[model samples]
Target: MELVCIECGKARRPENLFPMSCECGGLLEVRHDFRRADAEKLRALFDSRLALRTGPYASGVWRYKELIDPEVEEAHIVTRGEGNTGLYDCAPAARYAGVRKVWLKAQGENPSGSFKDNGMTVAVSRGAAAGFRTLACASTGNTASSLAMYAAWAGLRCLVLVPPGGVADGKLAQTIAYGAEVYGIEGGYDIGVRLLNRYGEELGFYVCNSFNPFRIEGQKSIVIEAAHQLGWSLPDWIVLPGGALSNASALGKGLLEMKAIGLIDRVPRIAVVQAEGASPFHRMIASGGGELVPEPEPRTAASAIRIGNPPSWRKAARVLRECNGVTCAVSDGEIMAAKRVIDRSGIGCEPAAAAGLAGLKMLAEGGTIGRDETALVVLTGHLLKDADAIRMPVPGPALEPLAPDELLARLASVR
Candidate 1:
């Protein structure tokens, strides 16, 4: 494996255990030779592994270890049964979005209640194998919870930096419950990341942020598993909410790799949705793929995706362009409305996760996504991850004290 710069195309050996970026200020992506692996045999092996009940084979992410990092020993693998999230046939959600077929990939069921576990397990495992005693990350919420839990499992010290008053109570509670040293930074996620980079060398800590190539490698399993769950057939579109843009990049990379290795006949067109208040990627695409402009003070109720400057912008843009995808931003009102629809389906998600449904509706109405096409919307986090956002009174319901005979009369009068 080699660390290849998304821009400048500079290739180099990863000197550190967790490679961050290139000297040219570009993100690094893990490049492997998939031509050496037999596609049909690999698919057969993965399918066979599904019958096994234990070890890495059962893990949704590690089941495709050859496609991720084959060099890592089995002993170094730290898994919490992550990545076996369900793919539900959400007909209600489809109708809401004006699509014929819509499947909700509920990633929130993963260990730590978010999609971050898909990447954290691999990053922490690699860090432990590389002799790193401490693991660190700058997170808004989900990443911190994931890193803390994985670090605890791997027996490594975890340090998390979060923007003051920026994280949700549930996520912060998870991080603290996992015994991580949490710091409240005055600035936001980007500032925390900058500080981590400045101090990581002296502190000897492995950064578990999406900037790490190994994390992306692990996150690629989301698409891999989704394809396998779909009987090796690719969907017409894959919609997801964008935060750091790593998930978009990872899914696109995984789809392309599957096609390269003959496991899939075609790759899906990816749609990345962003909260309008924190929509740098959407703006970049809207501005004709120009240089990414950061939103210095991104304001959104979707705290998980309230990222002003996504580090993986270039890589995500490349994937979107290559896959012929689109990026769109939805207002907070739209996001909450979509959230209620998803909640009514009993597959509730965090506000950030609802952005996918919101964007799907926008794209469907705009004729970008066809009503007859098959699409998959990824719900990234669990409902409890942002329960505070859902505390509003339930619509169309009111309770009043009444005598038993009056209640019976009311019940009899209904219909």
Candidate 2:
């Protein structure tokens, strides 16, 4: 395995504490020499691990350890049995998206009630192996909660910097409940991230943010496991919300690798969905592509994706280009409408998760995505992760004591 700079093509050995970016100021990606890998044998091996009831192999992220980080020793691996999330085939979701089939990859089902657990396990494990005493990150919510939970389990001090008044109550509570030392920064998520990048080394803490290559490696398992569940069949498209763009970049890397290794015959097209209020990535793509201009004050009710200047934008842009992907921004109203449909289907998700479906609907209507093409939408967080974001129904008149006959009459009058 080698750490390769995405832009300069410079390769280096993986270090105990690798810098966030390459010397060329480009992001580093984990690259493994899989040319000699036996595709069928590895596929059989992965399938065999599904029967194991214990240890790292059981983890969805570690099950593909050879791909994630082959150098990490088994003893150093820290896990909370994360990344066994299920895939749901919902009819209502399909109808709403105007697609023939829709599979919702419920990443929220992970232990942390968000997809971050998948990446956190690998990142924290790497930190523990490197003998780090502390882990830190700037988060809107999900990343903080996942890092804090994993850090507690790994016996490492965790620090989180969140934007003031930006996190949902449930997510904030989860972060605090996991025992992380939390700080509220004056500005937004981008400002908090800049602070971490500038001072993380001086503070003597390992950064667990998505900009860390290991985090993206673990997140790749979302696409890998999804393909496995579909019998190694490639979907027509994989749609996901773009926040820091870590998940989008990881999905592209995983799919391309799978295609390279004959795990799948073709790479699926990717669609990145962003909330209109926080749509820097979408705007960049829509404007014929250039250097990403960060949003100064990203506004969105989807707190999880309320990031403006995502550090991983370059990586994600490359992925979009390679996979023939498209990007779109959806209004908050559209996001909520799509969320209601998924919620009514009994597969509820947070607002950010619904952005993918909303974008898919738009694409379908715009004639970009065909109605017959199969697509998979990844829901990054559980419904309760941001319970406060959900609007409550208006209360009806208070009920009075009623006789059995009166109740029967009322029931008969109901639909």
Candidate 3:
């Protein structure tokens, strides 16, 4: 296995403490050597592990370890029952989006109540195996929670840097509760990440951000597990909300691997949704797919996706083009409306997660997505992650003490 630079195609051994970007200043991705493995035998092995029900096989990510990283020792594997999130059949969400069939992959059901757990489990495990004493990341919210939890499980010191007053209270509470040393930065997530990149080596900390290749490898299991849940059938479309854009790239990578191995015949088109206030990727797509231009001051009510510059833009853009995918930006109002529909269906998620549903509705209305085709929307986080975003109830009658006869009369009149 080797780490390949996405821009210059330079290959380097994965030996450094934190191998984030390439010498060419581009992102790095893990490249594995596969010499035409038997697809049936591989599928049978994965299926057989499901029946064992213990150790690494029970983990949704580790069960596909051969595809993720074949070199990692079994003793170094770290897990917390992550992955295996439910693929829910949501008829109400289908009706709302005007689709014939819809499935909501509830990633919030993971151990940390977000999709970040899928990546953190592998990243931290690799960090531990590399003999790192400390793990760190600059996060908006979810990443902080995940890193802290995984680091705690691995018996490593954890550090998190966040934009002061930028993270949601619930997520901030998770990092603190999980025993991570938190630092407040003057700028946003992108700035914090830059600071970590500059100081991480000197501080002896392994970076656990999306820029890490192992994290991307672990996140690939989300699509892999989703495909397995559907009985190896590929959906017509895979829709997800994009923030740092790592998940989109990982999903595409997983599907392509399966295609190459004859596990699937065709790759599903991907759809990435971004909040209007923080839509650098969507803007890049709108601008004829040229070089990405960062949004200097991204602002959005969805705190989880309020990123100005995504590190995985190049990888994600390539996947989007290869999959013939489309990108769209939705307003906060549209996201909240769609979230209400999801909440009513008893499959609630955070505002950022709801952007997928909102985008699906827009695409369906615009005829970009056919109503007769099957689609899957990925919900990235739990509803309680952003409880403050929940709308308040409408004003009602004032409370007042009254006699029994008067209360009876008022109730009868209202009825």
- Model 3 lDDT vs. the true structure? 0.90
Residues 17-80, model 3: lDDT tens digits:
4447876788899888766678899889889988866797799999899888777898998899
lDDT of 2 by residue, 1-415 (tens): 8888999998888773566777778888888888987789889989999998899899988998887888999999999888889999888988998989999999999999999988889889988998999999999999999999998998889999998888999999998998999999888778877777767878888998887888999999999999989999967999999999999999999999988988899999999999999999999999986889989889888889999999899999999999999999999999999999988888899999999999999999999999999899999999999888787664444266678998889879885
Residue 139, candidate 3: Cα error in Å is 0.6
Q: Write the per-residue lDDT of candidate 1 for residues 72-100, one digit (tens) a residue.
A: 89998999989999999998999999999
Which TM-score value belongs to model 1? Answer: 0.95
Clash pairs (backbone) in predicted model 3 = none
Q: What is the lDDT, from 0 to 100, of the residue 208 in candidate 2?
A: 89
Top of the candidates by TM-score = 2
What C-alpha lDDT do the candidate models reach, one value each?
A: 0.91, 0.90, 0.90
The global Cα lDDT (0 to 1) of model 2 is 0.90
In Å, residue 144's CA in model 2 sits off its true spot by: 0.4
